[model samples]
Target: MPSSTPLHTPFCDLLGCRYPILQAGMGGVARAELVVAVAGAGGFGCLGMVRESPDLIRQQVDQVRALTSNPFAVNLIPSATDPDLFRAELDECVRLRIPVLMFFWDVVADAVARAKDAGCLVIHQVGSVEHAKRAEAAGADMIIAQGVEAGGHVHGMVSSLVLLPQVVDAVSIPVVGSGGFASGRSLVAALALGAHGIHCGTAFLATKESFAHDVHKQKILSATECDTIHTDAFAINWPPHSNVRVLKTEVTESIESQPYGHLPDKIPRRVVAEEQGRPIYWMSTDSPLKSMTGDLEKLAMYAGQVTGQITQIEDVQTVIHRIVAEAEATLQQLSNRS
Candidate 1:
């Protein structure tokens, strides 16, 4: 898998992947299995280890290393993790010599510098151009301009159609577009938006290797573009004023739903589910992991607007292969017309 394809861009060399597709290191979904599958298939992946223990991080890194030599990333959210725990997780990645350290939420400048000092490439996902500039000033190697149409926890109000090119122009580093991207046509559109690569969450969440529950995958398959809702109903464990996009459900439409972007921390929280004995509180910043049990429909079902584009559950290899082939075809069509 060399960068000889028509879809290859400068970001391909930065990620050391054949295609300019990077699996979104979605917390609770993009685990070791999915990361390896994507990397082995010529796309880059990031392990979603946000708020995870140091021991678990080491175990996952070991698993990925044993399975594939392709460089992968470990995702961490400083805004969601405890200070001490964040330090420990950062230390673990640095100690393991992880190739890439991907971050979300408010950019932690010192953490970025430390990871870079440890010889790790730092990718900071930002929602606004000012923050993108801040990340670059903090020594981030790349930036992911996440639009409001993204799944899970959304960071910005603008759509990819508007925010992506602005962020690319605002920063000198390679910019990757996130949100509302799930197909080869979207990938070509991302390139047209001046993004060097595409970072996808909803697309990979439905893949066979994803850690998402079967119910979650099925919902995406059956959903449409209009089925996504962006609200702050699931902001228990994260920062206040957190905006998240999830599949529309009874929970979201119920009378108990919080006022948009305004959920009181004092709201009653019940343990609605568990993953490997870890409790998942209601309205927490987590979706149903594959290992989760109990009544999960009462919990969050994070999905992007792109969920509408997914119809079937494919393996990571097939997903990447199809996207690349389709992107190539799209490029040829444009060339023919010109």
Candidate 2:
């Protein structure tokens, strides 16, 4: 059944989910387990397939389908992915008849058109009102207006409190607020801002089903809202100039004192760890995953400013249900006001 009272919004109708909450497809953290749990719990789940090979995308897509018939999305980063690989990903997704493709970083018009042509609903996560308008112009079915305080690749500098409403007013499509949102209060705040939903990365990253390494999860649990630092120091593998908001580590402390510019993109990548036999490079945007082993600090420990609100770990279903119950209670309280 669908949600009610500020929990259900147009985003639910667009994605065919019971609630408008979306688990952001954070690379490495979002996998089949988390996606299935989220979808089964009546919220949207997206596979974090950023810059991955098409074969892996297919396998993960199949894995999610095997668990549930619910609608989910595969997230891809266009501006950061290799052109050839990006095209191949789109082709494979189209061939598989993927229900939705959630894109971030930039709104690639041609790629979005290709997905649309295949009858796939397109979602683009943007940082600014300009990009939101461009995504709308490009026929994106929904827009996740991400703020600078978000974990991982941050494209906009403004906080969601100011950015979400700006985006909601700028676009005709239903908008979802991203960055610094975790609890039911945050959902009510987003609704008040005219947003239809919330895209949560850090909150889901701490869930039991999340594929993040235990060490990384602990760090997030130990962090506060002020503990996250936004910087471009981890853009070695992807395109330069893209920024990420990660937990303050020994590395980020030094980077925070300097300018937020990218290291030379062509610099040699030092392998700091291995996950499922794949080399995890130093200064890469790859979040620590469960299969990862090595110097975990070398990789980005992505988290959002909402870390202050997250204290313990829970399963995906419990987190969603609690948030919904809280949102209902909050709505009732607000309704009783003068």
Candidate 3:
């Protein structure tokens, strides 16, 4: 259903953007093509910076820059990233004068100040009221309240529907609602709850330009809302531990059944597990390469709780356009009812 009310807000104003929809900075799965596609379509595209080295970050920044001149943000994992590597990447952003810098994991005041000093709009991703408060205190221009329904790693266990309004009520700064949002109806709900914008991940993950493999996209299209499970299985074996929201498959089920801290034993420790000789799950990297390779049934397929709501893989432009149009229509209808 489309929103009947015309949706317009401030977060969409500063950047001179047409829509308040934000393409989530999905770690592991976020790529240059996907970010550029969303940004070109009038939404903010974000590059996930977790696990990316300075060189890789530079290459990605160059790639995104080459694709589109539109504004985009880089998602930074503060804790996991090495201080020097992080600083170098930060310097690169300062040099490029990136439009936005979205920080996750933990917001350090010094780093926040540096980004601000460089003139980048800083948006911090948080899960709870406390985290929101801290981010705001640290000088975050915006806060992304990511609920448990969010895919990839999450900081809070609260659902977006519940967490968004609470955080909006508690904080004076702009709050962008995230988690389980894959459509305009979700966008309307976020704005109604006082959020300045909606951050979508799962919906974008199934797009044509997404880095997600074909098998994984099929799984996302076939999934139901009840198919998702948050597990620390991948985190247990990887460094810079992070949680994951994945579809409940055989591999995920086996890991979930085991007690915490025993992931390696439960799943056969493959030093060099590969799909067609290309290493997928490398013990050295904490990244979710398993999903990147064509192995959805055995590897992790991270998706939001709204996975079941998705039924097909569509073009990125079409997906973004539909969300904005539907959101506007839905908002219009709601306004008429009142």
Could you tally the backbone clashes for each prediction?
A: 0, 0, 15
* RMSD each, Å: 1.3, 1.3, 3.7
lDDT of 3 by residue, 93-124 (tens): 78877789999867688989999988889999
TM-score, prediction 1: 0.97
Q: Highest lDDT: give the candidate number.
A: 1
Candidate 1, residue 280: how far the Cα is off, in Å: 1.7
What lDDT does candidate 3 reach at residue 309? 80
Q: Give per-model TM-scores.
A: 0.97, 0.97, 0.88
- The ten-residue window of minimal lDDT in model 1 covers 255-264
Q: What are the clashing pairs of model 2?
A: none
lDDT of 2 at 281: 85
lDDT of candidate 1 at residue 95, scale 0 to 100: 93
Question: Sorted on TM-score, highest at the top, how do the candidates line up?
Answer: 1, 2, 3
Evaluate candidate 1 by giving its C-alpha RMSD to the native, one decimal.
1.3
TM-score of 3: 0.88
lDDT of each: 0.90, 0.89, 0.77
Q: Select the stronger candidate by TM-score from 1 and 3.
A: 1
Off by over 4 Å in 1: 255-259
Write down the worst ten-residue block by lDDT for model 2. Answer: 258-267
**lDDT tens string, model 1, 1-338?**
44688887888888799998999989879889999999998999999999999999999999999999899999999988999999999999999999999999898899899999999999999999989999999999999999999998988899989999999999899999999887888899999989998999998999899999998999899999999888887878888888989998888886335547556476577898988888888877778878899888878899999888899999999999999888889989999999
How many Å off is the CA of 26 in candidate 1?
A: 0.8
